[model samples]
Target: MNLIEQLKTILSEEQVTTNDVILEQHSHDESYHTPHLPDVVVFPNTTEEVSKVLQFANDNKIPVVPFGLGSSLEGHVVPEYGGISLDMSQMNQVLEIRNQDFLVRVQPGVTRTQVNKELNKHGLFFSVDPGADATLGGMAATNASGTTSVRYGIMRDQVRDLEVVLADGTVIHTGGLSAKSSSGLHLNGLMVGSEGTLGIITELTLRVFGIPEKITAARATFPTIQNAVDAVVAVMSAGIPMARIELVDTRSIQQVNTSLETTFEEAPTLFLEFHGSEAALQYDVAFTQDILKDYNCMNFAFEQDSKARNALWELRHNLAYSFIHSAPGKKLMVTDASVPINELPSAILHSRAKIEEMNLDAAIVGHVGDGNYHVLMMIDLSNPYEIEQAKILNEHIVNFALSKGGTCTGEHGVGIGKAKYQALEHGAAYEVMKSIKKTLDPNNILNPGKIFRDINE
Candidate 1:
């Protein structure tokens, strides 16, 4: 039987859509890549339904693309090969919230904001925030990290267990609530950041932290990027336990100031947040300010008022949107590269020089406390030379990071855009990845043309 016929029999007509409108919607993600329409879009409401869909697709050698909120900056869910786009929106139900255990079980389609809203009622919250209100599944798929990552690590660290549907529709539980494990191969590690190539995450058990009693946010400005990075390095080395430490270059600051309609010094700025008791928070800020003195901090300001602090972080969180607002019609090609903690300053300095030499209008910003940063370049997609310049710059940056024992991507996974650098970054590990991919997806139907391309082709 044909793939469409099999799908029709197993799922309701509304669950499967061949409509151009739905296909078009699922074709693209938040990236620079052109959209490719999927042959069909399926909304599976249950884990069993998803497994059934995957099983049929696997049996028929059909490509299956697991989709979350489509917030991925990389083209991980673009449906490039034109197969089944498995939409998980309908499955967005909070399955369970174990308050005593400080864990929550959620369906793949639930958004981070939604999780937070619900968890707020219980006085518990998930710490991983990528600033996009991205789905937990997509965050896990990308192993995403953001400002808070400096204190609470990334999505991978928060995941306690995953109910992943394998390529062959086998449902497997990777890990449980217990912290450490000395078992066999880490299926959880394999599934997280696999970019939907390994399997589809149906349900996730995530760690939740108690909402801090007091939150103090501050903004510090420096004359140079080096000073900003140096201050962050000092803070980290001092073990201050900052909840958020983000670096925004001068160019990005201008963009945010214009977009946010707020006056900020057009210099490298660091937004920081500390979470603790009232007294401890005060002491932390004082100590942080003292440390910043050595870096020649141009300005240091803190917000104790809830409303003002929210406004401050709102600007920092939405700084990426400032790039959009500044460029009006231009699309951004962002690079999330990370180097060793000590090497971050040099790495960012190198990137700044390359951008100037290339004469590209780009902004550098990131959760720099983790040695991870993104170069958000506003590219005129119509200009061939400009696109070529971006590719060259991206290659140069990736090569630089790889040479310094850094990763091609610190947060963004190797979707189609960064897949080319996989071999160089992974080497023999790349072959091992391919072997695993082949073992799990022999037909190469799950997210085809992603992570690894056809060797001969």
Candidate 2:
């Protein structure tokens, strides 16, 4: 029997497929990176089954690319090499909810939104939004964070444990369910951002938060991008806890107005959220507004009702899709870079200036509270000049961040998109990472094209 028949023995024949439509869907993520089809796609319902498939793939030297919902922004799920696309969607399940412990154990396929839905009954919620309704496993793989991450933290911070299936099909738990431990290597940290280049995560135990006594959402418009970013820095320095603080540039605001049919001001703005007791939240809002005055905040508005607040954020979240909708037949190229809180002003200003210099149509949006921002640019794939401009712009942003002692990618993990910068960004540590890859996945079959192309390269 061939690999397809062999895989069928491990799973139902219906679970192992070579359907053209499925292969096409699994080929790439929401990235401008080129995609390639896997030879087959296999749906594994359990960790044991995932282990079996990995064992078979490893022994036979077939590449196995672990895939979740494919909501990745950096080509994390793209099958760059022809082999098995290990689809984990069938494994979706909320295994356990330890209410008192403020934790939940879930299959890798469980999405962030799904976890939140389940936790809502217990008055709990997962904080790492990542904008996309992405699988928790995929979010962990990318170490994703979104608006609320300014206070709630990233996927890496929320993961208490991970059940990882190794390249040789050996299953291991990388961490304990306890609150804290220093007993072994920080494997949870190591695995969370591995982007499936290290091993396949079959399950995860994550931390959750109780709903705050009060939640408020607000928008602050600034006279200039520099003023907006500077105001964010001031808010941070004031030591008032902010649940979410996002920067949306004038261009992005324009897109939002067009897409959402709202008549908000087209200027640099901050989407703000405060979570705490009613009294404490009021204090945070007052103090934040006080600081914004020093930086020329143009206008301020807030939403208190849950439905209204959700709608406000929904508009911000859809800005990327709005850009796509406006640009006919154009793909998006997002530049990700993070710098120190103090350097954010210079970084964002320089980015805006550079885009204008290149005469590129782009908008700026970011988790400004974390000193991370993105340049959203539309590209025509058929136009070589447009493609080259995107590459040059991305590299420029990455280089600027590196010069300021920031990361090439703050939340988006280093999949194939950021692989080239790994060596330069990590320097000697990059070699250590390669060594770990060689030691853990000697065959290089676990998402082979990610992190970096090869140790030699």
Candidate 3:
């Protein structure tokens, strides 16, 4: 039987589809990388189904690309080899909520928002919010984190265990429900950020957190990027418990105000959040304000009410969408990099200088507390000059971060976009990674063309 006929035999005809619309949707993620449609898309409803599909593909030597919500910033979900795009959306379910243990076991298709909605009913919440309402499985695959990562940590920290399917369709469980263990290999960590090259995640046992007693938000505008970054360093040095610390450049602030019609100052600004008792929040705010004053802080707006605090974060979170809204037809060429905390000021400075030199239309924003940031630009894909300029600016920013002994990618995984930097950033360690990949996936049928590149091993 042909591949489509075999898929239909394994699953109902309605579950396995060759429709062009669905194929196009699974072709690429949110990245600007070129898209290629998969030959077939299969919706798997359980771990057994996923295993059977993998076993079949392993036997036939067909590539298998797992699909989530298609919200990734990198081209992590793009099917470059045009095989089966295993759509995991059919497996969405919150299997168990161990409220007393502060943990939850969910299917790979469960989204961050959906888990939070369930957790909220028990007066608990998930800590890692990557801005997009992405699936928890996708977040684990990329080891993603965002605003809350400055406090609660990234996806790797949240994953207590995972139910994974091996390349040969063998099912295995990694880790357990305990808080910590010294039993054996840390397979959970290894699989969390593998980008589907190592194994496919079937179910995730994640740790959740209780809602804070009091949550407050604030905006601090600075005269320059250096001042804003220095202020962030001060907060960390002082050991202030910050929930989040984000930076938006003056141009980005202007774009936000223009797109959202808010009256925020068009200056280098910091959007901060604090989670603690009301009194503690006030004390931290006062101490943070004092530090900012030394750095020429132009404005400080303290938001204590929940509505106002949400509005402040909404403004910061919507900055990228603002650029998209203002320019209807242009493609967004977004890229991200990370650096050590002390090196953040220089990194942003170098990036700004290059952006100004290239005269590219762009905005700068970041999770400044963690020394991670992004460059948001609307590009014309048809213009080779524009594409080349974007690549140059991205490389310049990545090089600056790498020179500081940091990574080419911080939160976003090394998809096709950042695959070329693996050898440059990792050196000999990159080879070890390739060896591991080739060992786990001998046929290289799982998510081909990711992380490592140009390997003939």
Runs of candidate 1 exceeding 4 Å displacement:
455-457
Q: 335-415 in candidate 1: lDDT tens per residue?
A: 889999999999999999999998888889988989999998888899998889998998888999999999999998888
Listed per model in order, the count of residue pairs whose N, CA or C atoms clash below 3 Å is 0, 0, 0
Position 371, candidate 1: lDDT:
93
**Tens digit per residue, CA lDDT, model 3, 1-457:** 8999998888889889999999999998988889999999999999999999999999999999998999987898899999999999989999999999999999999999899999999999999988888999999999999999999999999999999998999999999999999999999999998989889999999999999999988888988999999999989888999999999999998898788777888889999999988899889889989988988899998888989888887777777778887887777878899999989889888899899999988888999899999999998888898889889999998988999998898898998989999999999999988898888888998899988656554
Ranking by TM-score: 2, 3, 1
| Ten-residue region with minimum lDDT total, candidate 2 | 448-457
TM accuracy, model 3: 0.98
| Candidate 2 segments exceeding 4 Å error | none
Model 3 stretches astray by more than 4 angstroms:
none
Query: Considering only N, C-alpha and C atoms within 3 Å, which residue pairs clash in candidate 2?
Result: none
Give one digit per residue, the lDDT tens place, for model 2 in 224-329: 9989998999899989899999999999988888877889999999999999998898888998889998999889898999999999899888888899889888
Q: Which ten residues in a row have the lowest lDDT in candidate 3?
A: 448-457
